[model samples]
Target chain A: MGGFGAEIVAKYNYWIYVLLMMIGFYAMIAKRNLVKKLLGMNIFQTAIILMFVSAGVKHGAAIPILDKHEVLEHGVHAASVVNPLPHVLMLTAIVVSVSVTGVALAIMQRIYRRYGTLEEDEILEKIGE
Target chain B: MSGNLHMFVMAAPLVGALTVNLAGRASRKAVLPLVLGFLTLSLVAALGTMAGVLEHGAFTYTVGNWQPPFGIELRIDHLSSLMLVLVSAVALIASFASLQSVAKDLADRQHHFFTLYLILVAGLHGLILTADAFNLYVLLEITSITTYGLIAMGRGRAPLSSFNYIIMGSIGACFYLLGVGYLYILTGTLNMADIAARLPQVNGTVAVATAFAFMLVGLWIKMAFFPLHGWLPRAYNDAPIGAGVLVAPLMTKVTIYLMLRVMFSVFSPQYEFFQHPDVQNLVVWGAALGIICASALALGQRDLRRMLTYIIVAEVGYMVGGVWLANGTGLTGAVLHIVNDALMTLCLFLVAAAIISRNGSLAFDRLQGLYRRMPWTMAGFTLGAFAMIGVPPTCGFFSKWYLILGGIEARQWPYVVALVFSSLVNAVLFFRIIEIAYFRGGKGHGHDDHGPVTEAPAMILAPLLVSAAALVLVGLATGPLVSNLIAQFVPVF
Candidate 1:
């Protein structure tokens, strides 16, 4: 029990992300309100973005930028810099998430206009009618 | 010129999309011509790329002259090249048929619709061509976003259904991104080839296994495979027929192609098939169950459009099962089915579009006496129905034949049974439609009400006939296609 607790504490970042993801996933599936569901999706995407950003961390490394003269003279060591690829990839991800949110919000407005409500059950009932 | 033909294949649609948006604001008359002109250019370039690939083997084009493992690359192998042609050709054919429907559905927003349409074409082409794992995610989101916009432009409950799709699609895309994140952490590279190379060194780790699982689940959700397929039918049914004719056929098939890419390119077959026998067995069984269930659900749908949507779900099950069979024959069938199913689905959707334009509804009751009212349209519909039923001389039969052979070889009897059962179900479903259209008189009206032979316009019939013809031609060319194109790509099992 003690070792398990220690392991959990050591990798708390991953645990937090997983916990956040589960919460968002639950909201997405369980919520009755369409706006809430959209919020859940945003939270879900944010958790993943955080996971990706965290994956690039290094203990004592500096940022990825390097001085050209220093890199040519000393020939830089790979371990001295935090990985930049995940951060770069996450930038694209953030853009994608924003675009998705924009589209979802636009569709939500349309749904509200047509059904006069943002609840899934109510919208479905109206569709049935 | 040939060396960079792949660039043209993607760039043409992209540039066309921008041109449509800008020129459309000036004059609506230019929208259709611009869309068609660009799709034709893309198709020509795609054909040229296929020729180049066949003549000189597969090649990779580095974006901005940046080498792989650092810069993004577009890899054109036999499978991706064939898919490129399929995407371009289907977009072109569907565009030709979309004119009347688009004017009817989105009369005010035609340019905007064409803009989204062209971007989707470009995004699908990019999805097939990219080698970067991260770039694939971006392209996936681009396609999903464009699809959401297109579907929302539909009438009635389309906005609500599009909202559901947005929720489901975002989750799928995020799961895929998470998987790529896991791979990046382990391999320190975002290139698929680099990761595959590094994976063996980190084999047996729980992280690697988890990544594979996440990625496959993500793609299955995106492709609406069985249990995760709740979003597909309603979304496709409510979508504007113009968009339905395009999205229904290509989106799911391309995602299946991505699954194959992930299974083979990012992870070796040895790792996928040999290392995890238990998982592979479970997945194949799941696929079989999915096929049976989707086919059963398809049987219950009342509307023709809704029925076709369920058929798409069943077809997805076929390819997923074929891939999970983990044999050369099964994988070959999956690839071939991807092409044939795209064309088959397009042909059927085109027919639905024509019928919907005339009747404004596709409920089974409205279809009586359609055969006499529109013989040419019915002819195309019959060809599509035959293909769906796996009748000989249509492309569907050849692929299903290979799949059954694969199931037998793998001793997966449940999959074989499921395939035969689904085909039989399809026969009953399509024949029921055929019987109504051919035999029954129009309801609430006399036989005289069956008006003159006012067929769908020539624009719609031309593409329908061409696709119907391609069904036979593709089936006839199956021998060479398998030997030349598909055989070269199926990983040695």
Candidate 2:
């Protein structure tokens, strides 16, 4: 039990991400308002981005950069620099999330224009009528 | 030159999209021709890539001449090569048919529609060709965002459906990204082959299993397999006829292809099949259930286009079950069905497009005396329906044959039963349409009485005929296709 508790503490960031993801997921599925659902989606995506950014961290390591002169004088230690790939990947993911949000907002505007309501149930009622 | 063909396949549509945006601003008439020209260029390049793959076997091209593990790689094995041709061919044929519908439905937004159309095509080509897991995620979003835009352009509840799609699609994509992140943390690589190589060292780790689960679930949502399918029928049904012809045929099929890539390429067959028999069994049963339920739902739809959407859901079940059956024959059926179902769906949707263009509706009540009004279109529809019912000499039969044989070999009786049941349901669904269209005289709509044979315009008719012909041609060539192309790609189980 002590070892498991220590492990949980050691990886608390992952638990936070999981909690954030679940919260976002709940909003996306359960929220009645379209804008709130979009917000939920954005939150969900942010949680993923955070998870990816956290994956790149190495304890007591510098960001992935190298001094050319230092590298020439002595080969650099690989462990001294954080992994850069996950951060790079997260940048693309952030852009995708933003674009998705933009498209969602645009569609929401259209939905509002047509149905005059952002509530899904009300919109369905309007569509039915 | 052959080595650079894959680059051309990805670049032509992208460059064409930019060119169309600029040139189309000058002359709206230039949009269709420009789109077709670029699609033709890409199709030719895809054919060249397929030829090269057939001649030289599978090969990889590194983007910007960077070495693997660092640079993005575009891998063209037998499977992707066939898919490259399929994507390009379908895009070209579908675009040829889009000109009339675009002019009629989206006259003011021609350039915008074709721009999204070209980008969607490029994104699909990139999705098929990319070997990096992260790159695949990026391309998936590009295709998805463009689809949302296209679907939203339609009138009446299309924006709502597109909105729903955006939510579901984002969740699917984010799940995929999360899975990739997990794999990266485990293996320290983003390239698929690299990750697969490194995975064995940590094969038994919980993270690997979690990654696989997340990725598979993400793809299942994207493909709309079973319970994850709520967004598909409405999105496709309410989409503008122009977009429907392009998206309905390709989107789910391509996602299924990606699932195959994830299962076979990123994870070893042994890992996928032998690691968890219980999970595999559960998935196959789920697919069986999905088939029956989707078919039943299809029967309840009053609209013809909506029914077709449910049929797509059922077909997704077929391919998913085939892949999970974990035998050579089953995998072959899944792969072949991917091709056959795409063409079959394309043929059917094109007919729907033509009918909608002429009649302005696909409500079942509106289809009376369609055979007299649009005989050629109905003829094509018959061919497609026959294909869907798995009649011999149509491509759908051969794939179904393989899938059933596979199910029997694997003793997955439920999947086998579901296949037969779906076919019967498809026959009922289609023949009901056919009988209505063929036998019932036009009662309320006055134009149908003594109406001349007003087939779809030549542009639409030509592709419809080509796809309908290709269905039979593909069925006849199934023997060579399986032995030469598909058989090579089936992983040794």
Best-matching candidate per DockQ: 2
Chain A TM-score values for every predicted structure, listed in order: 0.95, 0.92
| Model 2 interface CAPRI class | high
Alpha-carbon runs more than 4 Å astray in model 1: B442-449
Cα lDDT tens digits for candidate 2, B198-295: 99999988889999999999999999999999999999998988899999999999999999989988998899789889889999999999999999
Position B474, candidate 1: lDDT: 96
* Overall local distance difference test of candidate 1: 0.92
Clash pairs of candidate 1?
none
TM-scores vs. true structure, each candidate: 0.98, 0.98
Q: Assess each model's interface with DockQ, reporting 2 decimals per model.
A: 0.93, 0.94
lDDT of 2 by residue, A43-105 (tens): 999999999888777898997789999999998898898878788888888889888899899
- Least accurate 10 contiguous residues by lDDT in model 2 chain B: B441-450
